[model samples]
Target: MLAEVQADELVSVDDLIPDQAAEFVSQLSTVEPLPPDDDEMIEDETSENLVEDDSDRSRPVRENGSIYFGECRLLNWTTTAKGGMKADLAILDCPADAVHPFKGLLCGKQNGQRLRVWFGELADTDVPMQVNYQGEALLLRWSDDSVNGMNTQVMLDDGPDGVKGTHPFTGLPIGRVEGHRMKMAVWAINDDESVIDPRKVKRKVPFYQKPETTQAHLLSRRPRFISYVKRHERRLTRGQEIRADITIAPDEYIAEALYAILGITSRSELGDENAVGREARRRWSSLVGEYFDDFYGRR
Candidate 1:
């Protein structure tokens, strides 16, 4: 009864080996030993899979491609090798669910750098163009050659993966571009208080504003402060005054600066803006005040 129960319970080859069944025991000696080294076997497998055609060596098997799913702000036009042209893009907003690891590639961790979009022969023209790779699409409108920046709403394609392409400049394997839509805005305030929209304007409208005296004062008083202000200057409205004192509450520039100085890289790290960012700004203001006090004492 015990043997019958054991036989019924056995469900796999492992159980049968331990049971020492007559068929398994008889077949053990006939089982051939594996080769000592598998290098020859591996070589044989590789040889069978490799393409034998020599003509295919002249060109890449797959073309290079990349999909950037974020708020890409056109900083300025740049000249490339052989007099080619490319737009410098600053990735403003990358989603948390972004498929690619684009943190450092989008912008440098320390000194920020813009991503380049090579226009090749099409640089001089003011035209709307489309760049599609691996289902990801970029609708670019080059109004004209000017410092006036532009922004657009982009949705990363989450479609079926396509043949990988090598980045022409970087020589890195470009994977599928996948992400969601992000908010983007770039416009200049006109003299008549009307906004110069990039979509409506056929030609690139130059973004110009009279330099505020307060801005110069802030620069003279605190040079380091300019870096922080420039990063978040988009938050300011037309003709918004930038205060010299850093004690302003709910200031985006101050909050961004505090995050940088404190080494808080991500928005997620800034838990509770009032608790983390606001408090840090307060402490920073106090520190700056003390520094000025010490300077006056030395004099």
Candidate 2:
């Protein structure tokens, strides 16, 4: 079982990370020659007495050039009654190829006790109104509920009566259009036009591989959405599933999002051979091992 986060921080070292696991990460840092000690006394101390801080020392290494990939599981997760239908649910899908820098893990109460993380800049794309779903330009506000780290779900059925951007998640007025593609802008806030977007923010990430189990997870997610769309959108009953494709500004965004969602890289680009999927699965196993090792070591 995964450790649960207490308060607002990561799980206590005793619960989440074990001493052996911590030592392993420390060993990796030493092998990789991570940042040298800045404190004169600590630098002079013998290895026997040196204590590891495990601070944000990994930050600079990320900037130096490390690619992060792989997906993270929301272990021992619980959901609100409204989202209970998705309870036994899992989703494993990634966008196009993208790059992201490594940001150390995030352990939070809401996100469970552990979270593997990375950082990177997202590519920029002008999603003209024509290419957007339906025919209107919709200004989207990224509420926490709608946008997960690399995944964003817009409830097409839940919006204002007439506005094209009206969302069912939250009843908000939206601007409407009739053309195939319309131009929309991402703003800091719903009304504010000046705040820069995080998608515009740049960074690099580790390249993680996808797991074969994820294929099963994907099959799980696809069906749930299909069922939901079919039940909610009467028009979709014509044997047509609601199509939603994951896209990023740069190809790197795809990779980054995949890593964020699945905590693994994908062999989708490689070939349809089961081997490719199997390889992705192998990588996921490695990642899980590393994650647990660090978790136990820290404890």
Candidate 3:
């Protein structure tokens, strides 16, 4: 009956008699709260619209599978340079007799006096990406999300041989169009933009040379990714290196982290058999190993 007390009864506390208090309380009745009619019916006083969905803004805009390719001159040659350029896009040599991932990606699009191709996967063909390579710097116009806003190439100087550029790999001369942005990934492609899995070809190395028991060709499966994440967290906990900033979280942000670290837009990319896909898988594996390895080693 105490639950039946209303604000008015509470206010009458000073006037209430101790002898009749129980009788007064027992005689009163409590009213139950009404359920909400509709979420939309509620009036919001704030100026901002808090109930809107805006996922599209955070996603990258791109034409899936479409890629632009360009050739770069082999101005300087160094294994170290090649390694450094691995993460970025560069015009690699793929002679007519051979199938080069870099050249194959272009799908024989446009060929002209383009010394540099400031391109990315679907890097805005509507407004062709233009690159200006002067003796001092490299400039681009009408850029896309693929290309970073600011980049400058300053290593080369015109030698007595008039701007002798070293090929990043062979240090020899090589191209009509040069790939600039490092974010662009070139997959082996055919006349169309469709990806070609070189491993699937049976003429060379038989597909079933040696297969695993329950072959998991894809490392990006959600379950596998989750396992890696849980393992990583455990390793971090054991090492006493969990972040205090709450920046890296598992489950909820697992997809976000995977995409960010792998530099891919889709999970399917993680399963692809191309250079980019392979590299992503390699990085993911390395990260998991590092987490456990470092934790155990410290002990």
Highest lDDT against the true fold, candidate: 3
Off by over 4 Å in 3: 1-250, 295-299
What TM-score against the true fold does each predicted structure earn? 0.16, 0.17, 0.19
Q: How high a TM-score does candidate 3 get? A: 0.19
- Report the lDDT tens digits of candidate 3 across residue range 1-299: 22333545333321221222223222222222323333222112221112211211211111111122233332222323323221122334323343322211111113111111222222343433322222211111111123332112122223331134443323233222443322222222233323323221111111122121101222223354456555565443344433322234444355544555555656667568889888776765565455345446742
- Lowest lDDT sum, 10 consecutive residues, model 1, at 42-51
lDDT of 1: 0.29
Better of 2 and 3 by lDDT: 3
Which lDDT tens digits does candidate 1 get at residues 93-183? 4443332222111122221222212211111123322232222222333222123222232222122322133221232122113322221
Model 2 C-alpha lDDT versus the unseen true structure: 0.26
lDDT of 2 by residue, 1-299 (tens): 00121343422322322332333222212112123444322221211122222333322121112122222222122224342201011112223332222122211223111111121111223221111212111221111222333321121212231224322112212211211111111111112212212221122121222223433233223333223333433232233332343332323433333343333445352234466555555554543454345436742
lDDT scores in order: 0.29, 0.26, 0.31
How far out, in Å, is residue 194 in model 3? 49
> Highest TM-score, which number?
3
Reference-based lDDT, residue 133, model 3:
25
